[model samples]
Each structure stands twice: as structure tokens, then as C-alpha cells.
Target: MTDLDAALSDINASAEEDVYVPFEAPEQSELDQKINQYFEGVVVRKDLVKAVRGNAVVPGYVLEYLLGQYAASDDEATIQEGIDTVRSILAEHYVHRNMHMAVKSLIREKGRFRVIDRVTVSLNEKDDVYEASFENLQITKVVIDPDTVKANEKLLVGGVWCICDIEYVHNDSPGSVPWQLGSLKAIQIAGVDFDSYYQGRRSFSTDEWIDLLVQSIGLNPEQFTSRGKLIALTRLVPFVERNYNLVELGPKGTGKSHTFSEFSPNGALISGGEVTVAKLFVNNASGKIGLVGYWDCVAFDEFAANRKTDQNLVNIMKNYMANKVFNRGNIQLGAEASMAFIGNTSHTVPHMLKNSDLFDELPDSYRDSAWLDRIHHYIPGWEVSPIRSEMFSDGYGFVVDYLAEVLRSKRSEDFSDKYKAYFTLDSTVSTRDQDGIRKTFSGLMKLIHPNGEATEDEVRDLLEYSIEGRKRVKDQILRIDATMRDSPVRFRYSDQAGTWHEVTTVEERQYPQLYPRSWNAEAADASGSDLETYAPPIVNPDAASSRSVRSVAPPLPIVPQGGGAAVIPDDDEPLFEGIRDFKAGQKGVSYENLLLPYLVGATKIQIIDPYVRAWHQGRNLGDLIGLLALAKDPADEIEVTLVTGETDKPHQKHDQLLMLKSLKDAADAVGVVLRISLDNAKHDRSIATDQGWRILLGKGLDIWEKPSNPIADARQEFRQIKSDTTFTYARIPVS
Candidate 1:
């Protein structure tokens, strides 16, 4: 076995003993007791599929079902035996469609045999019995009992891929056929006692419960930060609620459809093929219900690529997605299946919003404003990074089948009204708008707080997330449809007797050009004169803006310093803590980010770097002056002294003079004095200010890599680091 295979097999082993594990295990604590008590026999650890799934190209649920049958015990030896048993079963009994004759002969010889295959049941009105058909096996007209047919109505409409026993008997009587069902089992959860499940859920904290749910879906939640965790969990909304419609579009390899397709049996993940009205809604001539009537969730994978889509289908979809009811002939029909559309976008978030909108990724046929408005939530898939092996969980989580049942059982409960107790949303839009927010909120609550024991803060977090998700759809709809520009949907809410709180979508905050004239747009820019005049309305940057330290710099705390446009009351005031470290490939790094915070009130500043001698290096020095230009403090006559080693080249003196001349011109334009001197002995690099803050740099002014020309490609404000390097920043008190 490979290292990953060995590590996966040893997931149940003690952490110390299992040195091959690539990721950290979650803190089990008291939760393990609940995991063992209620979930022992019914569920299996999700990672076991990786342990035993070697060459078999089967779905995650397939491997999980086998593991559930064998390794459902807690004992190490028993689990190991069960793993081996499951592996053996897949190798021997699992049908290979390519070798159909061999499997058919085995079934005929054995009289009855179990095999994994897709089975769809149909009602025979003339015979008054249900007949089962196997897609891969090419078998049809096999009689299934009426009781089994009634118990699993999902089989009658959309064919379910299942594992069942196939029996063959040779009848002596004329016109008698012999293929019959010995037993049958649907791929999804048979049933779940939610009371017991809720009792078990109350054992863990909100964060712990959230992590457990993420792990149950086969992800290591710790790898994702809080925003990332929220984004990943939003994909599960469709499975937990009825008639929900969600869209996720971004770069590829983000596991956008993994949750819908292979994770559960109740969901159908289809490709972006030509969608006909009959295949999706109903076959009018045959009077058979389509996928919407049977499956709990139907996801359209690569949704943007369906160029040949019929306009009729889009029109029908728009109506059905909004009302959750459609007509087949004259018969009115309603179904509860949720809809998920996952696709890859060709343009970046900034690029799309500047020219068009995020919805531009879809083909023109399906980009109708009416069709787009029907969607309730728009998950920001661009925020999610591509899946890596380290993101896989090696901890205990529920088997996919078991979790599917739990989420489906939660559909009956509505948590939409639960938010009304703590907060009130603006009644600005039509019922459709309110329904969109409430359903998204309900779905998120069902996913994260199925037990209904969430704290007020936790509830608020989910509420904001739900609102932001729905806000993305609404904002984009306004861009697509001219009528929606005047729509009365306010992205604001209020707490009990508190001021109204407005929310902003992630992309809207990241690329403000899309929403150029927001109510708080001017307040977002916190630099120079703007900072002196206005303070940001929201304390938390994420409320409307993105990360607290993103493109929009926070107002520099004006304290007493000798010189600079900024001011403070007194020098005796205690200095507040200010320090930041940046990883490579990090964007939004500039001098305004590194030095501006420390040099706010300094009359004199020192720049020391040994290698600021080459032309590109001098250009970096010039860029530093440009940052000062952006900080244009006409009131403060600041003096900047550059101390660096001489360039050892023959014309070093001439080069140094020319570089200093350029720096002088740039600084003088910004109302500052620039001075330069050579120090051959200088080794370390740092910037010290008269205000008593030392900003140390491991790589000095050359912390960034060379940008290949055109400037826009390497603009550090939006550019990612191209190489691996280290830098440290610290502020020391001048005593």
C-alpha cells in the first residue's frame, strides 16, 4: 500500500501511533461518546472509503455502503476484518457490466445473488404489479412486491442506482418467465429517529457541531478559515431544504458538485447536456413524473456550458423554480426537489463585475433575467480554494447514507421564523424577495442547527451568511434586469430596538467597482484626507467590506508625533499594539500596508537596505515614494533618509546620483525632503521612525519579485507573490 493508503487504513489508530496521517484530527472530547452511542452500527467513518477503495471507480456512497455492512464496529480488529470483508465483496460480488455473461451465469447457477446496479421500478396497470429494470444489467420485467414498491415511491419515477439481490428460476410452464427479486434496498437512508439524533447533537458546542457536519461530508474543516467553512457548508443547503435553488460559479477543482453527486443517493448530479422539457419536468405522452418528482435534490453540473439548451426548458424552469409547482397536461403537480447549479467561470470576480456581472459565465440562452431571479442563494465559490489531499478528513464522521437521512428528515421543520425573535428584516421587497431570504435562512439553519440549540451569536452568524448568499443573487439580478434596478429589496436588518444593519456580498466588498455608488461607498476609502474627514460606519470590515486589513486601509490612529499630516493629542499617550505578518503569494501588500501605519506622525524616517542598487531595485525604491504620494500629507514636512550600501559597479557613483535625483523629484512633489547616503558596512534592513516604531524587513524593498512588463501584471496591490520568501515586522517602544 502507498503512504496515503496506509494512513487512511490507520485513521482509527491513536494519533501518536498513526504517524502517516497528513492532517490533524478534530478534538473528539465528549463528542466521541455520542458518536459511539447513537452512530456505532448505523454509520461508518467517511475516510474508510479511501482506505479500501483502490482501483474501483465507484461513487463514495458505494464504498460507504460496503463499509457500513462490515466495519460498523468500534473494535480495531473487527473494523480491520470488516474492511477486508468489504474489499473482498467489491472484488467478487460487485457486477462489472463489461463481463455481463459471467455475472448472469453466476446468478443463474447460484439461484439467487446480490449485485450492485441501478434499479428503476414501474407500475404495470394491466398486471397490477410493479416491474423493476436494471440499467447496466439489461434486465427488465422482474416482478417486485407491491409492499416494497409502496415503501420506496422514489423508484417509480426517477430510476435509483441501488444494490439488490437478483434471482433466476427456469419455469417449465409455457409463456412463463423466471427473473424475480429476492430482496431490495435503496441507496439512501432507510429511516432516522430524529429525536435521538437531536439528543446526540446537544452534546457538542456550535463550532464542534459545525466541524462534525463538515467532516461528515468528508472534509477536514480546520483547513478552511471561518469564511471558507461557511462557503463550503452552503453547498449542503439544497439537500437540507425543499424547493431550494442555489448557484455556485467559480474556477474549477473546488469540489462544487462533490456534495450533491457522490455524497448522497437522494441527489442526482447530471452533466450540462441538452435539457429537454420532457426529460426534466414530465413526459406528457407517457404521463410519467420526471427527476423533480422523485429525487430530493437535482444538481446541474457544469451548468454554464449548456449552450444548446432549449428556450422552452428555461421558461418552464423559471416558473417551476419560483413556484415549485408545474402542470403535466391538465394535471397539476408539485414536487419538493431542490435545485443546484454548479459551473466554472471564465472571468475573475473583478473582471466580470467591471464589464458585466457574475452571471455572465452562463450561456446567453439561460441568462434571462426572469430565470436568474428565481435562484434564492448564490454561493461565492471563488472564495474556495481548489481541493487538496490535505483537505480530506481522517476523523470519525457519519456515513453519507446516514447523514442524507438526517438532512432529509429536517425538511419538515422551518427555522425561517426563528430569526424573527432576535432581529427584523426590512419589509421592502415583494413576497418573492422575502421568500428568497427566509428559505435560504431556513435551509442554513437546518444544516447547521438541526437541533435548534444555537446561541444568539451563532444564529446571527448563520443569518448573516444566509442573507449575504441571497444578496449576491439579488444584486446580480438587478444588474441583469433593468426592472430590478428600481426593486425595493433592502439588504438591511435591525436588532431588537437597535439601529439598522446593512449587509454586503463578499465580491461586492472585494471589487467595489461593481457597486460603485453604494450607500457607504465613500466611507470605504480610509486614507489621507478621507480618513481625517470620515470614519468607517461599520466596525467589522467584513460587515460591508472584506477582510479588516484589505484594500481600504483603516484610519490611522492620529497620535502626537513631531511631523506629518496626521495629528494626535500628546506624545505621553501609551502606543497601541500594531504588527502584521504576510505569507508569500498574498495580495493587497503595499507600502501603505507595511510602513504607513508606523510613519503616520514621524518627522524623520530611516530606510536601510543593502541591495537597493540595481535599476529594478531603484524602481522599488521609487514605488515606496509613490506610496508616500498616495499618503500626500501637505501639512507635514516629513524628511526620509535612505541608507544603503554602494553599488560595486564601475559607474556606481553616477548611478547612485541618478537614482537619488529621481527619489528627490518624487518626494518633493509630495511635499517631503529626501536624502541618500552610502554605507558599505550596512547589512541588516529596517525602517525606523521618530515616532518610536521599528519596521524590520527580512528582504528589504525587494520583498516582491520582478514583474514581466506592462506594470498591470505585477501591480502588488492586486498581484500575488511569485516566489517563496520570509519577512518579519515588529514595532518596538522607544524608551
Candidate 2:
């Protein structure tokens, strides 16, 4: 065994080896080892969130603490049994918002029985005694030992949220309070053995470690392509590194704040309010630290700006975000918390590019160049799919408390310099730009290679990723604040051979308009704008490119705003017969552009795709109905027959029927009769119409993936298809 493996194995061996994991899945087995072999003793399976979680709403860190105590065993029965016990404890001892009176009665009847509640401690100067208050239980002025107050002073500030055991003493004794603190502990604490964490880290390869983290979040890495996996992993950055400023702006349902709110105890996902100086930084009137001082990460959800919020608050946050320190009166306080901004975009990528910058929706005050420069990374939340039920893994991972502690501990180390050996950053990069790159580099390194053992390729991938993230931040900044057009923030690096390498962000290459509006001005683009735009590049090489694309028709078709009838020209609405690219922020073309023309003038269309088994696939068919309504004559009836596969699994037939039936009913309401059939031998996916038009599709009826919401899905063009699949549209003249 490798030394790292032996070290991890030795630790596991030394502990009681009788622990068994439940559910016996391949993913579960991998999760079991990730905890024992790599993050041994320091990680917890997050799906345990569902098992132990009851009606009593509690933070994840608290349950993780309970899990680490009773359920941190490898034995399946032990884990299962532990979950039951934890559930029981929560039901009985944990305080519920509605059952506070009942819990109080239990404490009174039991003569100081222990119950779980949030305990905040403060000194009562008049009595010269320390007092504690239990949140939700509505109990206050409970006496606490001075040492207890001293040991957990976080309570004195914003009130450390915790699960505390309070004893209720009904005493007629004079000068004595009925409440007493039996036991007190913060809801979250991070105490990690960095040496052992590093030692265990040496055992796994880069891919293995990345997979472990992806699994830790209760997701299967195999489900996501490599780039998709990386996109998903970017959410973990704020957890591992301190004072890391990040933002993920995209459509809703992408689960942007899911990690901070649900996974770890140290992070908080607050509603993305316009910055408030008192809430985030400090409240000078109360002489208390704000969220920044207490939490490891503070994610702002629903974060799009209205351009009307208080500018002073925005300025204060900008300073804190950049410097990791905020001024409170005369005293300046430093905090270790990272900041994250998550929100949905109001406009389509193309609409924004043409009408406004990508950052246009942000509050005008927040769109300041000074603030954008502080962010280390910008995860394209657009790239992530809505969290479907299938995205979660049924596996074993460390109790979150263990992982939280490990991440908390690594905040002190600097992995930003680790990549310097293999590559040298260009001197032209600005200080803020360098800071952004280094912070991103440092966080990814700590996540994938905590032991600092990375091959040249691994290091370069991370480095390039780091630079790209920062570039996303900088590129948008220029578009938002034209004054920054002169900034020298080029991301260039050189290898040991002095072979200089320049990094171009994914958006930069695809959306070259940000540099010079004239770059693709004459090339035929997807937006179908008047300018001559060239077909953009495709991520999938097999997918054809429209490099030589030219507009066959001078005028673009204008369908009614809300799926109303379209005014077709005399010549078959000018069939779009050229290559079209939809990657990057490219606008205009969508499933509507691809499917509508061929779908026009056809009364019957048969969709042959085998994988229409899930709700999303069924929903894709539903959307096609909407498209059909737009192209319908309204006087002529339309027919759509679905030829999909039937799996042999139990309930498969029932589920497929139920889903298709719902779709069929909806299709009937729109002047269309929908047909469904079972086709076992169906391999190829295509759309055949009565007009002798047969269109070949790379992804079958699965051409359009799930968008952020139902509304976006209804508006076909608003949704972005991350998959690089091709579609061929051809019409045979009544053969």
C-alpha cells in the first residue's frame, strides 16, 4: 500500500472496524472509501440530510454533529440504527417552533430535563450575572456560568445559532431564575488535523479526489461530463477557502445556494438583498459583529440588482469583499467569511449583449468596476442544469461536520503559489487580477490536491481554470464600465521552457464582440441580426459549423410575442438552410429556429426518440406543442405521434403511460391529436412529417435540455442548450 493509503488504512484499522454502510450501491461503496481512505474521519455523507431530518427544521451542521457522534460508523446497520436514534432525539428533545409550549411543559414536568434550543449568552450588568436566551423555545434570562459565557462569546455578538440543552427549574427560591444552562456548544466548529488530512490526501489521484468531493455533495460525477463536473465542483470553492468572493448568476432552480445552506454548518445563504452595511459587516449601534465575523461563507441568494439600492451600503460591501475587512466605527474588524452572489438573469444572453452588458441587471452601484474586481470566480450558473431528482446520489459520504472542519482548517494555508513552479504569470496582469487568479488557484488546489502533489497537466488545467474564472469577472467589468477599457489585465503565462501561453476565456473566444464590435460584424450570427455574421465554433467537432454561413433571406421572421400565429412569407418562410451556432452567449437561434421551419406547412409530424421516459423528456414534447401552436393555421388540425422505447423495469409502463397521457390531454386542447406507441426496435431519432420532410436529430426529441424554470422552457429561445448536438433539416418534394 502507498504510505498515504497505509496511513489512512492504519487510522481506519485502529478504530473499531465493525461499522457497516447501508444501501450497497457502487456510489455508496465509493463514498464509504472516500470517507475512510481519503477524508477518513473528516467527511460525512450529505444524503444523511434526508434520513435524520424530521419535521423539526434544523441546520445541517447540527444534524451532522449528531451524526458524527452516533452514526459515524462504517457498519450499515450501525448507520441505519444511528439515523433512527437521531430522529428520535430530534423528535423528543429538539425544540419546534410550534411546540415550544409543549417542550417547556416537558422541561417543567421532568424537573429540569434537557431539551435542544438555540442559546445566546449576554452579561446582565444589573444582576452582575450572565444570562442565556433560548431561541424558538421563547425562554430568556436563564442563568449561565461566567465561564460558559466566556467559552462561547460568539453568542454575545449576532448570537451564535446552536443546539443547546437547557434545563428548566421551577423554583420558588428567591433571587433564582427557573432556567439553567445544562450544556452549550456552537452549532458549527472546525477543528481539523491538517497533517493527517494532507497525509490522507496523498493516496488519491486528481480524478479520484474530484469524484470524492462531487460525491460528498451527494452527486454522481459519472453523471456529469468532465467539464460539467468541474462546473459543479466550482460551487465548493467558498467552503474550502476563507474570504473567497464568488458569484454564480444564472436562471433559478440551478441550486446556486444549495451548497452553502444545506451542506455545511459554517456557511449561510442569505436572501440576496442589496448590501446592508449593518447586516453584513457590523452594527455600530449594537457594538456587534455581523455575518462576516461568524460564518465561513455568506451567500447572497436572489442577488440581481435593481440599480436603486443604497450606494453607501454597496461601497462598504465592496471594501469588505476586496479586503476581507470592514470598518466598524473607529475600529476595523477582519472576518474570515467568503461572500457569494447568486441570482437569475432577467434577459437572454443575446438580448443583454445587444441591448446591455451581461452585468446590466446588477444594481448600478454594484456594477462598479471596483467591486467586480474583488470577485475571484464567476461560476456560469447558466451551465448547470436545474437540480433534477436524479442528480442526487444514494451513497455514503462523511458526516458534514468532519468535512466542514477540514475545509475550515485549510483556509490558513496558501496553495496559490503551488502552480508557480511549472508556469510564470505575465507581469502585465494587474494586482487585483493576480489576486483573483491566485485565490481561485489556491482554492481548487486545496480541494483536488490538498497534499500539493499535482502533475504538470493537472496544474495547468487548474491554472487555466483559475485564469478563466478571473477573466469572466474582468471581461464583464469592461463591458459594464467602459472606463476600464484601458485596463491591462491580460491572463498570460509561460512554462519552464519559456513557451508563452495566453489564456482566452470561453466567453472571450465565443463572444468576440466584447473586444471589437467589428470582429464578427459582417459574419452571419445566430441572433439573425442585420450584421453579416459568421457561424460560431462548436465544442463537438462532429457537430457541423456555419463558418461560411450567409443569410439566404434578407428578412428575419417575426413570430408573435406569446406563441401567437406567425406571418409567413410566400416562399415557405425562407427555410433556414445554413449552419447555426448556439454556444457561448450567442443569441437568436434556438429549438424554435431549428424545428419551426421544417415543422411549418406539415399537418402530421412523428417524433421518434427512445428516451422519453422521464418527466423532463415528456416536458420537451409538451414544449413542442407550444411551438406547433405558434406555427398552426388554427383552422387545420395537427397530429403528433410519439414513438419512444419501453423499458422492462417495473412500473415503467405505468409511468410512461401516465406521463404520456398527461401530455396527450394537453396536446388535444391545442387543436392537435397526440399519439403514443412502444417501439423496441427504434434506434435512430428523427422527425417525419406528412410533407415528405424528415429531419435528423443528434439527441432525438431530447434536443432541448431543461431550462431554469417552466416559464423559460415555454419561451424556447431563452433556454441554452449546453450539449453540442447537430440537427439536419431537409424536405423531399412529395416523393
Candidate 3:
């Protein structure tokens, strides 16, 4: 057989084997069933992307668009047929750069041939015609008509993935091109019915819909917390919100550039991190527009520190990012493209907050206050977990091309004022700060609740999340440029009942010793003692439980414009009576930092949480017992009792008891007595001690989500908080 024929045979055999695997299939989940029921023709199994994508290097959206046409079904036979069809189509038509010569020869032999490739158009003013360039076919200056360029204008800016037909003729004449473009089709959904999409969205609950969107992005929502899901969805804001400016910096391997590059065809990812003014904004010399005129989002990838950039480009960017308009040759032009900058961070968050600012990794040109102030939100990318093979979902989700079209349609709707009915920002927040929060909140609302409906509590959650994102940008600016600290900004909000709540970044709360209360020069110059330099001390668990220590001063309350009470931590006295609230997704919290202070001086303790039957919950009970073992003297024995509920199922109850019995034996080896009591009616979760302290637990031992990595999860402080809880302390009744 010929070499080309042999290659095709090997690909066919591999495709057949990869299409199906022999295994016991799990039962369909409720959400997956609902997805297929409601959006049957627009959903497909997410795992099918990898199975069918053997060597075809194309954007995910392109492949999904094809899959949705042939394989959007739950039936195994239908799915296999669709996969085989897609693989055959790719094998016959998709152009590989290395095999371009073969494809070109085939076109010449057949007089006309069809292939899938990325096509870009450029205006040849000298020739007074438009010429096309095929990326993988390695052909340039193929004669293309002006009407085709006008119909698909995105071809002029950063190119578009397309299926095009080429006609070639043998020509011996001098100075003549033989390549001809017959037709072209971009690989995207042509149109979507907005009314139908809006009505379909009402079929699912908010949580279910959010999970659908997360799965559409190819992530398993079961593995992420609510906050982590939000962080992942925030990357789509630039697509749905017009003229939005966002910045995200964190460690590598977090998939920061994946959405912009592969999620949507309307977004363009500039991998070089630097571009000339002519290509990005406008070309004054040629009187042509740039990427902003064609794409919905222009993302800069690998944008790090020390890259030289033109001052004129930065100036034009600041104006366009702020006002959504730019000046070119005395003419004003406006477009709806959003801006995003994503890069890697060399230092940890604490290290940056202590010695430098978070924006220290950005180029000096972008580090200007005026430029930075235009950013609407700063995603704490450190909170995002790195992408793993297991993180991808195998369940059904919407074909991304359809979802992209839906988001593009949503860009025209505005929901910025939806939060005003529930809460109000503090007067100390500047106009720019308010705009940032409003834009971020508006985008998230559209993504989560497209029906323009949300409860007061739900609106409050989005509002606080929005404020925290913008506050991270503003707080780092205070550290980057001291001159901007003259006008201090306080990030606080007031509820309808006049209760004030201050929003703080998680890193600020985690490392209070590194963060300052005030960023002004006078505060820093006054005394080094103003900011505590010591970390949270690890007290010897072998010491007696009755040890005493000096108490530190408490933080001040955040009063609103209208005088109102706010909660504060009571660190001034021993045996304090107050509640400390932790936000969701906050890290660096643990049993030692949270409970050890109050657990001191207690010889006997009772954990009243009733949900300690699962393996993770049993691990939590063991951790508490281990804490007691550390707080007491090595020779002394402290009695610890756990009151939990028993399962109704026979096998589950048997396993729960076996796990607890094993934990009890491990506790006895450390000089602590472990006792378990099972009650079917136990509900309230709390920890009571014989030393006049009753600590309320909001989420019991299940405050944290399941861990992803062993090394990080081994330490409590490194785990992300899955739920928000308040630990209220009060004196026992002494009955």
C-alpha cells in the first residue's frame, strides 16, 4: 500500500478502538438526565472530546460544534455512530501541516477539494482585491472575493477556523497564482433563538444550572466548592460583559488561558503578551481597524513582569479600557471588546502582601495607577486548583458553541442595579470602586440567574463576592503607590436593617501579621509594633491545658455612614464571648488556630456534632481528639466524648461503628479517652467543655470540602473552606 493509504488505515483502526471502552457503566445522574431531557439536541458527553480528538489540533469549540451535530445523544449506539462519523470526516478533510503537499496534489488532481483549516484574509490594496491564507494548507495569496470577507469579517482579525474548498489549475504562465478559494464556512453556530434559550433556562434550579454551566466548561462541579465554581465562571465575564477589564495572576498550570483560547471563537488569545498598536487597536497608516473591532474579548496570555511595551500602546489601552473608545488620526472609534491579562506569579500571596504588592509582577507600563484603576475585577487565581485528568466531567453538558452564542446575546443586557434593593455600599467607596463592583456583580448575575430573579440572600452573596474581587485590586494599589493612599477607601456595605459588614480578602485575614490595618505612611512610620510580626504560635500540645497567656488588643469596628453596629473579634480578654465569621473559599484556618485558644484549660470536652459518621467526618473527630492529646500533659489522661447520629441503613451503620471503633483504639494510645454515643435525634452541633465555654458550630465537622492533594490536605490550614460558619462563644449555664 501507498504511504498515505497506510496512514489512513492505522488512523481508522485506532479510532475504532478509542470510541468505546469495556467497563461497567455507572447509572446516569439526575442532572445528566435533566440535561438530556431539556436540551437534547444541544448537549453531549464531555468525555467524547478527548476520545474523538486523536491528532486533529483544533480549538475545543470547533470540535464540539461538529459533535453536537452528529452525537448529541445519551444512547450508546447513537454516540458511537456519531464518533465514527466525526473521525471519518476529520480523517478525510482536515488538513495537517506536514501533509499539505498531499492535499495540494489531491486538489490539483480532482480540480476541486474541500478541507478544514484556519483562514485569514488580508486586503491587497495594490491588487485591489482580498487574498486568503490557509494556516495548515501552507498556501498564501489565494484569490478570495471581497463579499466573502465582508460576510465573515472575523477573518480579517486574528483569523477564524473554517472549512474551505480550494480549486487548483496547472499554469505555466509567469507571475500567475493557481490557487482559488471556492467557498468558506466558519466553524460556529450560525444563530440562536434568544427567547427559547431564556425559557429553557427557567427549567433548572439555580444550583443545577450553575452545575450545567460548570460542566459545559468541561469541569466536574462535584469536585469544586461554591466559591471555586464562581472563580472558574468568572473567566467568562469578559465574553458576556462588554468593555470589562480583568486581571488574574497566580502559579502556573491553573488553566488561566484555556477559556479565552478554546472556549469561544469570539475571543482571541494573544500568546506573545505584547502586540503593536496597529494590530490591537487601529492602523493609522493603513486606515484599518484592529482586533477590538472584530473579537468580543482580547486576552493577553503569559503577561508577566519586565516585558518592554510601547508607551503609546499603553496610553491607548488605558483610554479604551476606561471609556471603551480610542482615537485614531483624529477619528473616534468604539467597540465592545473586553480586556483580560493573565500571568504567573513567582511569590506566594503572603510573601507578596508582606514585602511587595500583588501587581509587582506586572510590567511597569501597566503598573500605573490610572491604568490599574480601570480593571473591574482581580481574580485570586491562587484559589483555583490546577487542572487534573480526573477533574474533567464525563456527564452530558451543553455544546460550548451554543453556550457561547447565548453568552454573546447576554452582553446587551444590564443587571448592575439588581443588588441595590438588598444592600448599599459605603460612602467611602469611590465612584470607580462602585462601578467596578457593579460591573462584576452584573456579569455574575447574568451568568447565574439569567432570568433576573434572585432572593435577597442570594443577591447579597454576589454583592459581597463582587466587592471582595474589586477590593483586592484596590488594596494592592494602596501598597504599590503610597501617593494614592491620601484618599482612603473602605470596603464595607450596609444591609436594609442598618447592619454594617466589612469585606476583606481571604489572604488578608489569613496573614494578619503581614497585612497592615492602614497603608498610610504615618501609620507605617509610627512604630513597628503597630503591625504584629509574629505568626500564630504553635503551643505544645504536651503542656498542661490550664496554661494562661497575655491577650492582644481587638480590631476596631467598621462604622457606616449612618451609625450602625458591626461585629469584631474580641481578642482583648481570656474566655471571650463573641462570634468570628469566616467566608467561603478562605484558606489558612484550622482546629489549632480556631479552637485551641478556647479549648485551653478544659480537661474534659464533648463534641455534639451529629454528622460524624462518614470517613471524612470520622477523620475530623480523630483530629479533635488528637488536639486534646496535644493540649494535655503527656502523663495525664483527658476524657473526650463524641455524640453523633446513627445511620438508618444496616450496612452503613455497621461501617460507621467499625470506623469509630478503630478511631477509639487510636485515641487510647495517646493518653485520651474517646467515647462515642449514637442518637437518632441529635441535631444541634456544638462543643461544650467543663470550663464554662460553649462553642457553637454552624457546619459541624464538615466545614471543609474533600481534599484534592495529600500533602496540602494533610495540614488543616492549607485546605479551602467549603462553607461559611460562625463560631459563637458564650458561658455555659452551669446547671
TM-score of 1: 0.67
lDDT of each: 0.71, 0.69, 0.80
Candidate 3, superposed: residue stretches over 4 Å from native: 1-26, 520-735
Top-down lDDT ranking: 3, 1, 2
Look at candidate 1 and give me any clashing residue pairs. 559-568
Where does model 1 exceed 4 Å of error?
1-34, 123-129, 170-178, 517-735
The TM-score that candidate 3 achieves is 0.71
lDDT of 1: 0.71
Residue 49 lDDT (model 1): 76
lDDT of 1 by residue, 78-113 (tens): 777887787777777666678667888888999999
Per the 3 Å backbone cut-off, how many clashing residue pairs does candidate 1 have?
Answer: 1
- lDDT pick, better of 1 and 3: 3
| Best model number under lDDT | 3
Kindly give the number of clashing pairs for every candidate. Answer: 1, 22, 1
The total number of steric clashes, by the backbone 3 Å criterion, in model 2 comes to 22
